[model samples]
Target chain A: MSTATNKKTVQLSHGGGGKEMNRLIKDIFFNAFDNPILRNEEDAAKLHFNGNTAFTTDSFTVAPLFFAGGDIGKLAIAGTVNDLAMMGAEPQYLSSSFIIEEGFAIDDLKTIVNSMATELKRSGARIVCGDTKVVPKGCADGIFINTSGVGRILNDHISVKNLQQDDVIIVSRDVGRHGAAILMAREGLALESELTSDCATLWPIVEQLIATNVDIHAMRDATRGGISAVLNEWASASNVGIEVNESAIPVCNEVSGLCELYGFEPFDLANEGTFILAVPKTAAEATLQVMKTFCHCEQAAIIGHVNDRKVGKVILNTPWGSSRYLDVPQGELLPRIC
Target chain B: MSTATNKKTVQLSHGGGGKEMNRLIKDIFFNAFDNPILRNEEDAAKLHFNGNTAFTTDSFTVAPLFFAGGDIGKLAIAGTVNDLAMMGAEPQYLSSSFIIEEGFAIDDLKTIVNSMATELKRSGARIVCGDTKVVPKGCADGIFINTSGVGRILNDHISVKNLQQDDVIIVSRDVGRHGAAILMAREGLALESELTSDCATLWPIVEQLIATNVDIHAMRDATRGGISAVLNEWASASNVGIEVNESAIPVCNEVSGLCELYGFEPFDLANEGTFILAVPKTAAEATLQVMKTFCHCEQAAIIGHVNDRKVGKVILNTPWGSSRYLDVPQGELLPRIC
Candidate 1:
């Protein structure tokens, strides 16, 4: 019977569901993600959920594990919570499962799990149930996490097809920061400015949006293919044309510089904490006012509008007064950029 | 863009959230797990739930991907749904996330996903949302799958702490087949007799037991640590003693042979589809009758009973009438046996 405190690294026994596995779970996971529901230690969590619930799942396989602003644990929690928040839901319960290599560092695992617990507080979400699996040394990378969330729907009107003609399109914050931060880390670049990933939990800001009763037609977080994917999906799903003023899109100087050097388009670069919304022209000003209250969202701007002029397409109007179709991203830009 | 037929192996572009990614999702996953909710094409799935629910998660990193009788996909689905079943819940919805290596075979992915769909039908569980991520070659062995499930609770009294002094302990089927089969695969053992994993969904049998109104105090699948772990947990949690008759426990000849050759204890080996149940002595016959009607559970047997003779421990009664304590399995006997 070896204590987890004496172990510096994880072994296959840590996942064997034996005495050692229980010790690690208690000394680490239980201590970090402690809650009434999680403390029950049942095979499955018993939860009380009623009416409509938004359910979403995401897996985090970010390279380097630790990034500029956040690590994989923070990303795992924020990613799923944001997915639920995008549906106008109150992030509630989450299940965190880990796939760790045989020789992963115990300290690193604890640090990652601690980050997850801290991030969960942003939305008051609970990690109710979990599973841990360990593979041989070379079977997997250092670690991978999967989180699935279930949230109560506070506003059920949000839908991809709910966009109306003449609706205003809003971007929550500056784009391309997350993609650029990861690229910089992978290339071992030490630039003058300190760039960081925009990865964060958006439920706090979203709760305010819902509480204020903003008539949000649709909402989505710009993740893998960035703002371009979200707008293109909306245009096709709603059978409406989206016109974006390229000059109005907010891109930080750091992100733009990285994009320029990497030959990447800012619109197609991913952002973890950023989101897009569709609102009636009448509600656009109030929406921006509520959004600006959050420091991280102070730069929120109206970059586009929806109409039937070019149905089922996204047209980007450059600052020089020339417009062109903004096609969805093709091929792979960077793998494991999440 | 290239057709999926022409792409023999998955490329990084297949996970880029663009034309190739969309094509891959549609041509492979959507075609296999096709349903209205999954085809809705939203960031999250909208589900309606009332009252108490059971939520659980598991990540499958089983070796060889395909084993004797089941693959990782089938194990992923059954493992999660069985957790819900153990909680006396009606399996309803699931969210699946896949982390695939860059050069994995598309055909193999199709086969695995198709197996998942087939397993889901046994429990009437739907895969409502999914995520796909591709890492560069050598980052992952082949593929890993995570499944999270939400099910409505039908019989809420089934809990590990609900065991009573006079309860009857039951084994749903033969034990240790799953662990033995995996060992056989890994060791390249070619015995004259056939051996396969006892991996299957147990929701049907559980539903029958619920409908029959058998007084099930607690139920758990004999998974990672096999029957030994479950009994020890029940005894410790319920503050009761469990006495098992070694002669009463069922073990297939092939499994016993493997155990003899490998010097492994059958009670400590894992069993995916087998389960343990505790019921009042009065309901023991009725429980066995209900369980025996299922073809897979033809060997259901009453292997033990709960008592206060030795609290917080499990005692094994030998055929010679002597008894000894059955402690929890200690170290990693096998990794990735799930």
Candidate 2:
């Protein structure tokens, strides 16, 4: 009930809004996410925004907390900020809230907080406000974080409804690494080389595309439902058919091998940092060029084009000159992969 | 792993970014929080905000999802919205994210979502954006909701640090009802008269105060650590002493009784809808006059005054002609208290 604790694990008082909670917040969160807006110490953060802004929220309950390459903390920040970036917005401010289960390791908490601080540097976003709640033991697994963010839209023209006919689709890199990595970690699969999650922040690449004036019509990270989900939604929203050459879509060998082993489709698996973009056919080359200059994006390629045929559907062209309707992913691909 | 289930409970595939998940979102969440912004179905909500805005985030893990007077959904919306209101901001757009444990009842989700929609009507705030994830059963308690909100600041001078030496402190109404109500609900205590949490939207009263142009110095909801916590923070933030008349402070008989039974201080109990305000001594009567017009604020009264005597401290003067330093709460009073 007081400050005294096992030191190895979190205590109920660590979230009690008292001296101990103050210590944890200060020693860990405040120290890592130190910023003027956060240091203001008000109930809500004061922000100045002009014109249009993008707001988004995401909750990360990824199992194992720590995966092959990233932890839940990294995914939490990247995922929310990426939502802003996909809207052609500059990631600016974020709010982090933690739901910690009693008796969870304190050292692990520090590590997660540190990962969050490190991830913030990827997009220059600041965590301005946060809340911590400790539940009774067994009430929660370990820790779950909910991050919400807002940023000014640098290019207001980007939207899922803006995918015009003849717009070319580009995958930022090889798809499905995130889902595969988590699967591998959870199933204890061994491979010749370790496969890490593609959980890096995509803002820098997005910023470059904006700088180059690539005429981005629609941008979305292949998270949760993965590329298939994003494409299906775009097709239905814009009332356009998307045709993709299966041979052209980038898929790393590790991801392909894992998909084969697990009887899953690479396009249906989640990707934390990977994104799919819709740009005018004329901007395809330029978009790919700009994307390839970024780390982990060397495999970026133009793989599809929007059309009026097969409205509200995605058609995938195979290597043998055959095609099939690429349906929206269905039924429990994976839970808590994010 | 498709939509087939017991019909009364939620399934894992409902969060798998597939047909089932889309159906769940539309049938439950979207149906309850119907609006153009939410219907757009974009990854993030597009909002236009000019000038200064107040942003806040809160995660609600309150146990017994349904409690006296309000549920967790109501608490989630009101808690974040209240933070904005306390900063003299108009509650506008809110983002809600949910972390659900697999196999939870679907009917319960509908009830919670409905509660959130009804609460949104309290301040006309729109649910502009949201996220949902389902963790395997036992990974989460039942459901945890995180709400992040942003709104235009109506009175920019409202801040804890803005407290002045002669500012009078006003207690919005009788305090400790929320904390006591939750306790009673959890313990299944039998009481002749029903006691409910003071959980209601405060923006209506706050808007009126702003419209009247009362020189508001500091405003804060006594949420987690209650009035004692807010006063201590204000005193420390402004380096001013606060002298509170114990007799003038309002405490309902129900709350006072529960406080005595639990060995808890009424002032130290959390309040969901109650707030404390510091205004110029000359405007105390005007503020009370405006507040009393509201439904739940009939007991509004001036409870204390700011002083220069004991900097960074709150002195509680009892009717016995003795005073004691009211310290900031320092231990776990109750966990998962909104």
Candidate 3:
């Protein structure tokens, strides 16, 4: 659980462009999506592409400008890079726009910009264009970021449409790491064992996939609405049903216990560091092997398989030996947990 | 001067997704950016392009989850299409991502979405992909929008760097209409003479430009930071100085009077319905003649002339027979004035 220090209504410390911000970034966002580009603590992620084009964008507005793990600077870069990777694109150029509240600290602004420059270096993306605006204090929550990315698409053959009926579903790692980490930080929930966020870039994993001839079909980062939302979207888009053995779905023991205590479903919680992949039966083994070379993918597994569109829904075979339909969440179960 | 009614704080009427919203949108955003697609008021903007590809996105977040200016729906579509026009790209496709506040009005959301459908038709763009998220209420200010646009690069000769000294600056008329209108609606700054926003699509203007064989250097829409920011950026980017004759710059009389009362500088004020064109001295006459055929360009004028790099700065020749250097605004003068 998060400590009391984590739960104070969002303060400037969260966006202060200081140590607190770094802690927040590492503890929450970085932990959720761990990967090489992010772990390098660089400005931007560098990626190489063979063909096609990749495009993505991310908007970030954390209550405080600075935080424990990172500030809006790192968040903006990492978020967009991850989005491109989710589409199997080699992240490249980026455009950033800032909406700042009136009377924001100029020093803080400079810090954020410098941090952004640093992260951009790491990410290997150039800031080609940018925009800035100021909103009345009451009209905005300090500073908000909107970043768009354009990358070279690696392979046109890899796409969501390629998913076969019996393709297996694989998650990069444990669930609820991102959501729970944020909750703990936001609510200051105390826990015997500390838990941090799982935010990190997945460019390395994507690179690995591109280098290998794995029969990967669909790929999506499990964020915002979490694993449930992603799976639902994939199922709907691919016109297939999914059947998962709950016990096979990887979940950190600590996260599972925390979710049980909070009455939150691990599957419903958001995870910034995780991604979902659909692979053909024959390619699943090789794909999982490639993924395991990355630290965050060690526990990855094929927890489910695609079904015919006639089955058109998600079902979970629970640990209790009971089967239940998992419907697309109608609304957000954990708001602002991103 | 604005009336007392125009000074009241914004309420649900500003984003209600109804007649009030329509009024607010027309009176502010649309009024500032008047163009063919916007005037049509269709479901999407139809476009014709001859290039590799185009990109666009629209993100909407209206506080209270709704607004008088067609809610998050209309704004999202219009905003994205407009962005494409600024680049002289025919908006071909768009992507939307929604960050909804938890417990928002469901019916309101549907209205916004429906509005987007209509606006997209009017603009002649397609909604190719989308994303939705519900954040806890306090984490967001009702709703925020982020839109991306994609269009073919059009003519290979079009580039900002093409701007040369002696180029004439042409502005789409009625400066500050959108910014001032939004301010009035948002702040309830009522005036005896009602002012409307200039938020419309400029694809037609862009199409017209393509039809004209006149030499063009660069183009930019006066949004966000407005004409002052745009001019300064264009001057710096093109490595040329710009001299604007104050009397020649177009300004709606009502907006001028309001700025006088509010101590805002018309040049520094934001404008959505306006665009700046930099054309070679030789092609200036023909370009202006062609532009005059459009209603939106009625008040268009040759406001300034680009000069050599030695004078690579913006200068204003005042009505008082004096000249003053107009520096790029170091900070935002009007918060959320856009």
Candidate 4:
């Protein structure tokens, strides 16, 4: 029979579906994501969609909650939004659900909610509907957020199986920053260098590519298993072999150092905002030009090209002019990277 | 660098975005919720939507996982589907995400997924997209599920703020079954009589009502906080008063016994499948007739009416000829009852 009034931390009563729960939702979630659709206060949000739409979902359980570049809040929003953007969709409406542990600080929740609001602004997407569940202490970690997004598809040609022969593979920027940054934070390594996660909304850049009509064949963000995973999936799905020059792939000094020290492959490390693109050879220069215009993607480069010689495989050519198969990562590299 | 080859329980590698993870998704998830959209294998599922759509999201963290009538899997599907049905929408697409703890039994995970697939068949809603994440042992309770759904809005007139004066309020069936069932399971009450949760998909019944052309004003499932919370919300949002006949509200014997022993009110308990509807007095008989035709809602009855006597409040008329304000339930009734 405990009341949650004037409490510093969340209580079980805050999720009891009663007066206290209503007040908490209005105070935190509604206050931060204020909009007309949300204010309607209906059981669900009513929206208009008149064409091909893209729907995606992701649950963020990144440990440490906070990191060098962004917190779980920003990652939750950006992750789902990027899934839609990678399909050449205009990120529009998102639904967020939170499972918070009891006794979690109100201040921390507010900070996370505010971060979500800030990230939503980058893509003009609105948090139209949501649910909150509070579990007893020790039942769960601090909190986990699941975001599901539905957006209007700007181009229907973007897909993993759409890669064309002789298509150029482009890495948006330096790989492995996000995975390396998280590793450093977990290892308690306070490096003197500036190494932050490449965690930002990619809609702005994707929109520019779409507006420029750069015929994107295949596009995917290297999230969990990084570029190696994406290349393998694309190779199998499109039945094309990928040839990449290892020396041409961009890797920051910090990430390379972390990988060297930890015996991890840079290509297999996750990236929050970095994405790989497969475009026709004729559109490669135009795509690179558009991507480089963005500050975060200034180092975007052509890393490889699609070929049929080694079908259903990814071939990496090292600086020594010897090539080897870059198979799909078979075991766990890192946990909770996203 | 351990692998999950033929493992009986889940490992961290199953969510590591590698070979093991892909195999698990394909063998279990893709096999159960199979459909063309899901088989497309894109970052986002491409859907075609014309006109208005309804979107909603929910996360299920029910303790014990299994319950008297429905498990968390079925609850997760029906809960989100019911939200869309409450808005006079046809549930169409759903995205499911699972957060599993390391070492959770593969057999149990399969059963939950099977339950979700079974429930989705009730509303003809397809799970078009999903995400899965696994944490280290003890980071989460056995498992948690989050489902987000989008559907086409059939009737835009139904809203929380659309209640008109003299609108008759009809409850679908007896109240408090869901909350009582969960409580009983948690407390280990071996009641002999049948006392199962009313956790079924309500779209079929709602569709019948919509097809009958009933002029529905406000409709909401009495999930958490039961009918009391729903009525209070309607009154405040529509700026009207609701007068409910206390005795007219139906309550099962099991629920009554539990409430009497626990010093609780049945009005404040939760019901998963039970719902309340507000329609003009002329449409009241039709609504009840439609509801009564369903076996689960055979006890459908008119319990209240909307009026301007007391703005933004609910009044309960007792059998003793005395009336009192029915304030929204306060404090915690039960946590994780969903």
TM-score of 1: 0.98
The TM-score, computed over Cα atoms with residue i paired to residue i, of candidate 3 is: 0.78
Off by over 4 Å in 2: A1-5, A190-192, B1-5, B190-192
Q: Please, what are the lDDT tens digits per residue for candidate 3 over residues A1-338?
A: 24553353233333322234345455544543345444533111223333455555566764444544456677677777777776666676665656555456555666676667666665566654444444445556566777777776664455544566889999899887877776666666635456766667677788888789776788877766567766765666567888888999888987898888888778877676688889889999999999999977899999899987445577888999998876554433444443
| lDDT, model 3 | 0.63
lDDT for model 2 comes to 0.91
Which consecutive 10 residues in model 3 chain B have the weakest lDDT in total? B9-18
Off by over 4 Å in 1: A1-6, B1-6
TM-score of each: 0.98, 0.98, 0.78, 0.98
The Cα error of candidate 4 at residue A66, in Å, is: 0.3
CA lDDT, every model vs. true structure: 0.93, 0.91, 0.63, 0.93
Q: Candidate 1 residues B233-313, lDDT tens each?
A: 999989999999999999999899999998988999999899999999999999999999997899999999999999999
For candidate 1, the clash count comes to: 0
List ranges where model 4 is wrong by over 4 Å: A1-6, B1-6, B190-193
Worst 10 residues of 1 chain B by lDDT: B1-10
| TM-score of the A chain in model 2 | 0.97
RMSD of each: 1.8, 1.5, 9.7, 1.7
Per-prediction DockQ comes to 0.86, 0.88, 0.13, 0.85
Q: Across residues A1-338, which tens digit of lDDT does each residue of candidate 4 receive?
A: 24464487888888888888899999999999999999998889999999999999999999878989999999999999999999999999999999999888899999999999999999999999999888998888999999999999998999999998999999999999989888888888746658999998999999999999999999999999899999999999999999999999999999999999999999999999999999999999999999999989999999999999899999999999899999888777878887
